[model samples]
Target: MIISVDHGNKSIKTPHLLFTSGLVESENQPGIKTDCIFWDGKYYSLTEKRISYLRDKTEDDRFFVLTLFAIAKELEYAGIKEPDDTVDVTLLIGLPPAHYGQLHARFEQYFLRKREVVDFEYNGRYYSIRIGKVVSYTQALAAAVTRFGELKKHASSYIIDIGGYTVDVLKLRYGKPDLAVVESFEQGVITLYNSIFSQCNSQYALHLEDCDIDEVIKGEPTILPGEVQILIRKMASQFLTEFCNFLGERSIDLKVSKCVFAGGGSLLLRQIIERSDKVGFPIFIEDIHANAVGYDLLYKSEVAAHGGQ
Candidate 1:
């Protein structure tokens, strides 16, 4: 089966599941009760190793390793077992537009022909898979295709994909992507999440967990103090304000006839941005996994473009 993964700084998302992108490589094996992948005498699972840029992220080998992990989980999600402990499959993934040019070839070449063999345990089950053809795309543009399908191709538009650790903007004029005006920045949900994390930490001296952060972002009921609740609302307001300020100045929104805000951040930003009088409401921002969906939807076209059936 073909698999697509959007490896964001905060999460690794497959079609059916969202795995925390907080992987840590540990020397000791995890307890039997723990859910983890044991490979090469080390255990790998969600930890606090959140990273956005290449400088701070793991090396290329670790990327390949994580890709293997994703593949294993992908197969499990499909309810398939690896005969001979090796299953061949095609893979599609994306990179930030800013990093696309520099990193695309490297990632493409990483798993070109090798029948990658991986043995790992997920949910206490042992599984293995042989990695096969891997293709890559610019995450933002891939998303733009789905968010703005061919039916609306000719419309001038601005796409702002607010990811976990990066904000990728693409300006489209007359149906063609305007790379010259495209921009990506470090500002993302993690920025706001981290700020809120620190604010609660300093104000209450309480180290809240990721679940708590998730609740705060999801607007779920929480036991946090009323003052902190006010602070949470304030932080959300500031995030959207800064987001609008950045999008207006950074993206070519003034020149476009349409605007779109995609990615997980869209969910949180939508409510606040809509209530604001300054920013224009977007027409499309539905699926949080639009990139993966787009990749799957456009797979045949892409393969055809590459001279395949």
Candidate 2:
């Protein structure tokens, strides 16, 4: 089986399952266990709080363990509660274009454990899988695979992935990615969250959380003051303007190029972006798992290109 996983800084997404990237590790089993996995003599439980931004995910085993959880969830979704024997698996994963050159090789090797098989227990069910192969691809460009036909009609198009910790941009010239023009900006949704939190703390003396701001943006009922909520909307709009200006500073004209937006950050700022006259009629990939889906498509194409590998 070929499983594609998108390791976002905020969440871990597979074609079938999406979970927070946060993992709570403990030496002993948890007293109240739910969505817990036991691996390598350690117990891990999924949580809503995300891990800190990681430039290099393979610096530790956290992401590897997250991949285990992702695979287990995918298997369960496929009606495999517990495998009787080791299952051969080809894992498709990705990294941002900026980091792909330096990290893709190590990222691939990180999943290919020295042992032939990996065994773990998830939610009281045991799963054993052999890593047949691991393929890593560029992240932002992969999300734009579904639009290749439309993009090829134009002279150039830009894929703007507004992710959790970074806004990664990839240029597609004549429907093919120009790797030379890839850029990653540190200003992402998380950065916007921090900026809002800081302003609320200073101006209103309100200690705002990410969820609180999310509620305001989503037009959900919240206990926050109407004034604070208005402030959030205002700042969000300003952020969108600044983001467009940043692109302009880099000589990227959204009006001239077909700009496609993807990733979690894009969804969060969708309204603000759409309202901005500075942006053109932008295309949005609403599916948060678009990258994972693209990775799957890319892998099939690659296999077919290699004559069924």
Candidate 3:
């Protein structure tokens, strides 16, 4: 079976499952645990016992646990008998454009052709699977390929991926990643939310969780009051203003290539970008799923191109 996993700083996204990128350390495993995994010198909780994971999870062994958990959850959802099944698996993941080259070999060494036992319970079901091969792609490029598919007519593109933690821009030339202009901006959607959360907590004494803030960002009425809503919008405006200033300082040549906006964070900034005449009508695709969808598509294409080699 082939699977793709994206360990975004704020969330873990796969073609099958999406969960908060949070892990908790827990001991006291006396009487048989239900949904925990022991891997690479750490005990991790698969379900509720989580603190937000913000660092480079891919560099450590937690990536495997997350992948196994995603596969197990997907199998449970698919009604497959998964306990003790040593299924062959091909794992695909992505990285930022700037780090893709330096980390490519490291990630490949860390994940490729690995056989490890993953025992976990997902959705009231038990599962065990042996991991097989692992592969990776550049995040922004994968998103662009996913957006354009095989029929992409453009020869070059500037992929502006506004993700949860970082906004990465990759310059693609002649249908390949041009690493020279790859840039990563610290401003992202989480920055906007974090600003709002901190402001609300300081001003209104409202301690809202990340999930609640996400709901509000999606235009849901969270009983958070119109006053808070106004305040958050103000914060968003300031964030946009600052982002615009950052863009101005960078002096990106928008005319050099077609701009494609992608990632979950893109949805919030799409209109702002459209309104500003700076970006030249940036194209927006399936923001949240573009990278994973692209990874899946790439996996299929690779398999077909290689004749399942």
Q: Write the per-residue lDDT of candidate 3 for residues 13-104, one digit (tens) a residue.
A: 77667776666545534245555555444556655323343435555666656666777665656767645556666778888877777777
How would you encode candidate 1's per-residue C-alpha lDDT over 1-309 as one tens digit per residue?
788877777777776666666666778776545446776677776655554445233355555556666777767678775445556678888888787777777677675536656666665667666566777877777787775554265556777788887888877766468767677788888888889889899988877665666566567889877777777778888887777777677544422346677788766667766666545646556777788766776786877899985
As for candidate 1, its clashing pairs are: 22-47
Off by over 4 Å in 3: 28-55, 58-61, 112-114, 149-151, 173-176, 253-257, 274-278
Off by over 4 Å in 2: none
Error of 1 at 200 (Å): 2.8
* Highest-lDDT candidate: 2
The per-candidate count of clashes, in order, stands at 1, 0, 0
User: For each candidate, what TM-score against the reference?
Assistant: 0.86, 0.96, 0.82
Per-residue lDDT of 28-107 in model 2, one digit per residue for the tens? 88899589999999999999888899989989999999999999888888888898989888999999888888989899
lDDT winner, 2 or 3: 2
Q: Which stretches of candidate 1 lie over 4 Å from their true place?
A: 47-62, 110-116, 121-126, 150-154, 254-257, 306-309
Best by TM-score: 2
Ranking by lDDT: 2, 1, 3
Candidate 2 has what TM-score? Answer: 0.96
